[model samples]
Target chain A: MRKIKDLGEFGLLRELGLFGQKLPEGWIGPGDDCAIAPKSGGNLAITTDLLIEDIHFRLSTTGPRDLGWKAAAVNLSDLASMGARPLALTVGAALPKNLPFEWAEEFYKGLRECADRFDCVLAGGDTSSAEKICLSVTALGDMEGRSPLLRSGARENDDLWLSGEPGESAAGLLLLEKGLSGGKALEKCLRRHLCPEPRVELGLLLAERRLANSAIDVSDGVLADAGHISERSGLKVLVEAGKIPMSRELCACAAKSGADPFELALGGGEDYELLFTAPPKNREAILEIGKGLGLGVALVGKVEKGSGVSLLGEDGREMEPKRSGWSHF
Target chain B: MRKIKDLGEFGLLRELGLFGQKLPEGWIGPGDDCAIAPKSGGNLAITTDLLIEDIHFRLSTTGPRDLGWKAAAVNLSDLASMGARPLALTVGAALPKNLPFEWAEEFYKGLRECADRFDCVLAGGDTSSAEKICLSVTALGDMEGRSPLLRSGARENDDLWLSGEPGESAAGLLLLEKGLSGGKALEKCLRRHLCPEPRVELGLLLAERRLANSAIDVSDGVLADAGHISERSGLKVLVEAGKIPMSRELCACAAKSGADPFELALGGGEDYELLFTAPPKNREAILEIGKGLGLGVALVGKVEKGSGVSLLGEDGREMEPKRSGWSHF
Candidate 1:
């Protein structure tokens, strides 16, 4: 018999998508960062994320504050992918009865801090008892009359752009798993893994300037998310591994741990950076916008007339990946 | 030394409320059924509910289809409490890896059925792996330029009205716990427990006519919910135990189980009925509206200028409750 493990997370999501297709006019269903629902005069973009203890985080390596911050940031990153302005968020938590009240206070403190930093309000939520800690954060944003940046809008010949560095978060996780944490570089990687920063400003700016044709958050690795754009847009995404940007911390951590940086960069998940496709003509403007926000923008690849994603090595040859990305199953 | 269990669910919620007070203009935060966010043209009401396996329901008693339906219905009931018209819903679920694919298909079928029946759309969601099944359903509704019916709006001398009987679901739960299920009465209670119908129609009518001064859904028992109204409105709620409606199915189940029917009627939960307050002068109009809708509306209580909730017995003497309601902690 086919089980959830056999179908896998992506397969299960694909099957679930069939049940939500008949949405209302101007409404976008599953498959994007946030679902779009047209309200009063504008569109409301919403996204939800579920995080389970041990599956997503371990208390030994993660503090309550960081856990809460990451939970809210991940959902905000979804809104950012849609170029939606932050508005509000609701958090539903299932906490173990034996958990200390101080842990909850610290968690909410961190969650509120993140929402406040992003100019979003803490809305409402539900709390219940559970044997394990479970969190569900739902974030709502406003489109402000602009069309949402969907994954299915990447045109052929569009340049693939990524904000910030990838692989640092995965490298940090490896370090934590190994119980090795010290030095400035390792500390930076650990921080990245614990508390990811959502590119909300760049997302809103891109939408305001109409810069990008397609966008997605780096929750499922750059290659896997690029595959999403390919499947939705019916185009091929060719990513140049040599051109993928890497942080110094990630490189140091990889060298110390005897791991390949490219593998982590291409296959690791939960970076919360924005990956987008834009017309080649807007490269300079996009670069300038990134500079204005003090963020780095890397041109990694391009869209082509085909299907699936391909990783080209420095030798201009396709490289087979050891692992594509993290799968829940 | 204080743990979540010591604080209890309500106490924890009260503490959480402090973190959400400084909201934007025209926005309501954590104290209502759904947080109210002023959108482009009107207000949007959003509420989220979390259901954990064993904590909220046991897999031995609940089928996958019923679990999905109940999850959606509970969130919709919260929206109904605000008198908001249902718009869209997002579901976040964490399922064990060993679960069969057919279970998911059945679950989504029931979830879609309930959402479709209420004119709501399934927009987007997240799914992950967990040790036990955990479901988080977030529902959104539109106020359509009308003021929301708030729990804090009950005025002195207002009549407290309840739609539908309140004890059937709890009685049904008791029967299931006792492994006793059969006959028409027990079957009816079981259905009520499995597939609860939200008071959407009655809520809309009351909001449309401005007939309700305050409103709340009966998820945490009638007395506890009335206590919420009293605390929020800074008034007193007085309920006549004899006037509280009791379903024949609930009575039969309670009698068979050797449980007190009045205790279940006043302090049991998960009924999804609307407990609202209206002016004494609007009693006839409210009764006519209920008759037109083919729904039974019973006047069982009153709001007075005092504090807290008080339950009066058949002889007009205050009755002390043995247990107020379900407490997560």
Candidate 2:
């Protein structure tokens, strides 16, 4: 008789996930933002992301345009994780009755700005009245002729790669929550949290070159998301804690706020970066791709023949973390 | 400086509709659930619909299963309007944290049931927490080499045909609101209000045989939806008030509740029925298609060389309705 809140979001998902288990042939995953069914000749990847006011964000900390941009960005980030070229996006918004028309207009502007930047179209959506704002964005991507990078494709002995820094977004959220502002690093973290970019180009490059074995977006922090790949692929993902990438801004902000940088980097969520696995042979190529995109790429971990995720301290031993990651419920 | 509430949903849509207007080539609409781009050898139609608790439905009157069914049906109805064969659907839900896990299970069951019946796969979705339950469903359909039936294709002198009765859903809602239960007719209205069947087969038939010139599903009431066709097609839709179809259940429920059946048929929303325009020459064929599907079809109006929607009284004079339609705002 436990409620969903007691079960938590992941438990509820696990319970309900049994329904959509019978996916069509050639489909990727209910586990990895499934390919669903093939459209025409190309594989189509679709993912929906929901953001509720107060739960996912606060109107006080987040502006209307940034809220809009982040909404689209998060959904697109799902598409990017699958190595799919963005095609179209639809937004379903439930806004308060008293919301300004100008706010909505700016929201759409940000949505379109992100969609346009990612070579996707803002096709259509629904608008409704709600007590609090709730936005749902569904993004569709074309895999073209490339095979979709799935979370279940990782293999033992594969190198685990991560793009961009992971902890800045969580650090940025902390600063916003504590009403701490000022300083260049703090401002950068705020922007990182507010306007997180999707690695669409890197995903495409990986898919095109057939470099990645498995991939997932780092939304629920590195530990939880890596655990996703581990669970799906039935392999262990071991991360070298010292190798975890943290931006200069994140370190600076963590120092100023007296927060654990490693904790934020590992367990804090809302980092829309990509974490993927590949053979060590492709390491040079991936590094080249990252350099081409002018994005920070790092070799953070390795896949082994086991299960779940583990973080190793600088001493090369397992590290017990205070928190693993975030759960919506 | 007007708020969106003052602007209303339609007015706000008009104001913010300027962005995303420059759709890629071969795209059908920002107007008629636009085919943003061609996929493979077919046209892809996508639409998103949002249903918020208290605004779109009341948890007291609606069960979780029916709520799930209606959420899927409304989106499928949009695909039906476009004469598109539904391919897949993604649901984005923001549920109250304290909701029962069993409720979510039943909801997914109903969602899958409707999607399965319509030959659409429940591919993927996002789940999050909110104060109120808000469901957003995005439906994808393949036109399969047939030209998408746009809302702008209705021409002058075309016969405007409607499938099934319009007021039943509204009448059903009336019954539910008043908590009037008992008689078979009243029960039917309540069922209609709770569970609506999307006309997927009929839409496919219309598209496959090229019968409907333009079409739109009536969610915003027949009069309001027909107005969409009229405005998009650059033609006037003249609906005979007397010809507005009402089910036997709706009539009985209206009489007992002392509500006007015509008003309910014209302005009461959530019909989820298809209202379409076809050339006069195709009337017989269209009727035959309806007969084959075992669906009720009514030639309710005609498309003229004008704009907007007009309801003519039995005396052949234009009648002013008490309300044009339901607005979310």
Interface RMSD of each: 1.2, 1.4
Worst 10 residues of 1 chain B by lDDT: B13-22
Residues A1-329 of candidate 2: C-alpha lDDT, one tens digit per residue? 76888877667777887434776676654667545468776878888888888888998999988988999999889888888999998888888888888889889888888999998988878788999999999999988888888888999999999999988999999999999999999999999899999999998999899999999999988988899899889999999998988778999999988999988898888889999999999999999999999998999999999887888899999864444777788
On DockQ, the candidate that comes out on top is 1
In candidate 2, residue B257 scores what lDDT? 90
Per-residue lDDT of A273 in model 1? 93
lDDT of 1 by residue, B1-329 (tens): 78998888878987765434878898987887888998868789989998889989998999989988898899999988898999989988899999999889888888988999899988868888998998999999999987899999999999999999988998988999999988999999999989999999888889988999999999989998998899899999999888998888889999999999888888889999999999999999999988998989999989999898888888999865554778877
**For model 1, how does the per-residue alpha-carbon lDDT over A41-73 read when each residue is reduced to its tens digit?**
778998989889998999888999998899989
lDDT of each: 0.89, 0.86
Stretches of candidate 2 exceeding 4 Å from the true structure: A18-20, A320-323, B18-20, B33-36, B317-323
* Clash pairs (backbone) in predicted model 2: B29-B34
